[model samples]
Target: MVADAPMTPVDIEPLPRLARLAWDRAPALCASRDGCADYHRSWSMLRLVRAGGKPPAGWRFFHAEIARAAARGARRVLISGGADAGLLAIVASGFRNAGVVPRITFVDRCATPVMQNRLLGAELGLDLRAETADLREFRADGMDLVIAHSFLVFFETAERARVVANWAESLAPGGALLMSSALADEGPGALWRPASADDIPARKARLQAQARGAGLTPAEAAELADVAGRVWATRPSDRTGGLTEAELRGHFRAAGLAVERIACKPRADAPALGAARQRRRAEIVARAPG
Candidate 1:
């Protein structure tokens, strides 16, 4: 979830007509629907409402992020899950401006991205393509960038690892994998969970794993247990290990990508709880073999 939006996804009435029209023309979504509190949060949810969230008054921040990526020579970046074409277009535009003209390979379970990419590609004459292939089998070794913001967090523990491992394979050895998530293992410790939350099981699993990795037995794992906030915590996560700092490092160790850094601010209202207050996860950059 985004910092601005409420922790939970409570449905709010959509914005007015003029508001939506004005929003559609801009870049990113200010909220999930339009005017509640789900401010620009995950690269995923934000992508769903990109055309329906941003007011004409803003879009620079959205443009800037894409521009920076294009400037770095991301000529042909891949948006793993095609559902975020709006988000991909945001970056594609930047790549176009840089004269690189990106080709977004929208990979998803359905043809939504295929349809969207076809339209956008036709309009911009971009080399966009949509694929229904499984991530493990999809090819992507020469791409400049690969992204899967929140989609991977939906996988089970073992599946998540396999997905990341496959992502590692798809990458051209040194290409980058920029994933966004709500989980993190960097914190003083967690205190209480919101009445509507269910991260304890995942927390226990990871803490247990950590203790085991730290030379603890099952009994010891139970003894040295605590919440380290959420890792790649976008809900429906079994454990944040394959995505959190610890997980990122662990995956990188096996994948060859050295994580650069993570970004987020812990919860402010109840920060005194000493919980890890952060939103954005980390961006892991790897070097592809030439």
Candidate 2:
């Protein structure tokens, strides 16, 4: 993973309990807001990392990919922990109204937004269910398609490994799991926690190590480092902050997923709400058999 050379490495210490609880209070705040969710849902992720590069083109790109899978006899698609549901909506619409339909399901931790999505789906007459539980519970077993859209980076280091392990275990052989995440210029499992220069590099490295213990070789580790670079560049104005490249790469390797394609860009609409500047990605990782 690409990282800044530490001028001097010092022993790191844990945060105070009160301070730690408040560690990501801001991200939680952002997640709770409507405007923020809307902006991010509109491909704001493309704005970061790809200022001059191509925009995400939205989940239409993913829909086309899924269509290809259906043509090849794939069935059942699962999207885990996708809070915004924009991508889920597109996928569900395509499957329900379009010829290349797959059974669509969605899982999220909270149901407030998900319930709203379910109502919207009802109005559209699409059969999409949003469950209030960890994504790990969703099973696309023996199903033709599985998708983890912008889902992997939601947790901390150990959580990424567990997330991958669960997803991997759930996969059916020859049933491809479509996994996507907006990597920072750093690593894959990065969430935009407000970080100080003094704190980020070390914590990032530790997480990277945790990822390594989970899987990725050193070389592969560095390769995954490019996820958030586009985001950092695309939205220089973002107060939420950018990712360190090392952090992005380290997480992918840890998850046992390789970088299949890394297309850097911003959305044409210049949106920045749900989780803007999403680093475009498509990765196919080896799933261990049961």
Candidate 3:
């Protein structure tokens, strides 16, 4: 039998009650009226109640890297994307566990998640710097650690290089960028294949069931399901797709960061939204050369 990896000291705290409240209020707070609010609302609900509320795969590796940076007297952490405060909380907890308190900056285009992170920060008694800006255009310097989980998939193939370059520029020498991406067999320029019309009912039903299980009222669950269907039906044709392993690595190296470590593994328990295709999850640690 393969031996399990030794456990690291980083512990992922449970999603705070305020974070849940932020998610619960997301629909109203979301500025995107074109089904974007519904998109976030449904996904946030499912994520909150997903089996065991488990952190994403390879979280231990992320924790270890964050702890190491903290031990090295690193500060000025940045989170490149935000759908919720979950990533912020994880990074903060990692630094605290490592016996260092780092200043954290969170950037996201959407105001709702920025507010959410602010609320979460207050709840955790941590001062969080939250910004509303697109990652491709946002810039900072002297960052010791930057993290973005499942963030790259949202950008088109042509836009990814710029985003990676921005990430590299934001880091100080010897600073690290820790990120994860969903991988696919398809190459660049491949857009996510939208769900077929026939599949919408089944997908909505599943989401509704999951929402109810997550404590949404029956009516609220139905609304969430309806909104999800609308969003999927109208999903943009240019919605960027997953990156192939090669594309992911190339983007990092092209941005002038040294690829320190990368691990990709199949996610057996991924939700059914894209279950028809084989998708792997990648956890990467890249560093800016001193």
Candidate 4:
């Protein structure tokens, strides 16, 4: 059941006003909600490659662990940054099929995925709700589990820590948070960086080469270039990037959550440039102390 009182004080700070504004304008700026599906499919393909053409070990563990939580009586599950609804759908379906009823909530601002999630919930007959809410201001106590995958990278470093604290505080004591992401060993760079004067030609050349190598027709390549350019146009300057496993654990611990488990491997599918961005990625499960 949802708790009557909030576990923590309301988060007074908001992400940079620009960050919120950009996100609010994303639908219009990008003019492509279907890209969300493509994004979900790309991640699935990445997992296959990382597993040597099989499902990644981490994903297997992810499913098994959620089922275990459900079996242990976890009923209120929240998936933060569930904008795509792809992972949320899988989680809800798994619990429903396993006969473990859960009250699943999707916290995302985008309307497209929110609509997608509702349709999915109706089809699966799972108890699910999509809330177009800002996670920074989100509050609920007695949450059994929270999932945040590929989420923290959207904010600046300090913002990431604060958000983590909010999530940890929202959980009932001993409740768990599941997170997975590729991490950089050094500075947490922008998730999407703008091209500088020197960067313009270099980025253009790279995109052209990539498109040609992928066998995209001329029109498709031009379209991809247009999309790529627009992405940079909307990028937040202080966007968060990656963190080492130890570094991520430190964030949880600092927030009063204990590091429960960590699984890591080099990015098996990363290209040369991608490898420079991050050497490896990790899947982590951390819990609030009971």
**Sort by lDDT, best first: what order?**
3, 4, 1, 2
**Candidate 2, 103-207: lDDT as tens digits:** 666666654435544654565565566666665454445555566665555556556556665665555655555655554543344434333423534544543
> What C-alpha RMSD separates each model from the true structure?
15.3, 18.1, 5.4, 10.7
TM-score of each: 0.57, 0.50, 0.81, 0.65
Total backbone collisions for each predicted model: 18, 41, 0, 0
Worst 10 residues of 3 by lDDT: 1-10
Give the candidate number with the greatest TM-score.
Answer: 3
Ranking by TM-score: 3, 4, 1, 2
Shift of residue 271 alpha carbon in model 2, Å: 18
Q: Whose lDDT is greatest here?
A: 3
Candidate 4 lDDT tens digits, 5-46: 322111111112222233244445322543443333222222
- Score residue 41 of candidate 4 by CA lDDT: 23
In the range 128-159, model 3's lDDT, one tens digit per residue, is 88988878888888999889888887778768
Q: What 10-residue stretch in candidate 2 is worst by lDDT?
A: 6-15
lDDT of each: 0.48, 0.46, 0.72, 0.60
The 10-residue segment with the lowest total lDDT in model 4: 6-15
lDDT of 4: 0.60
Clashing pairs in 4: none
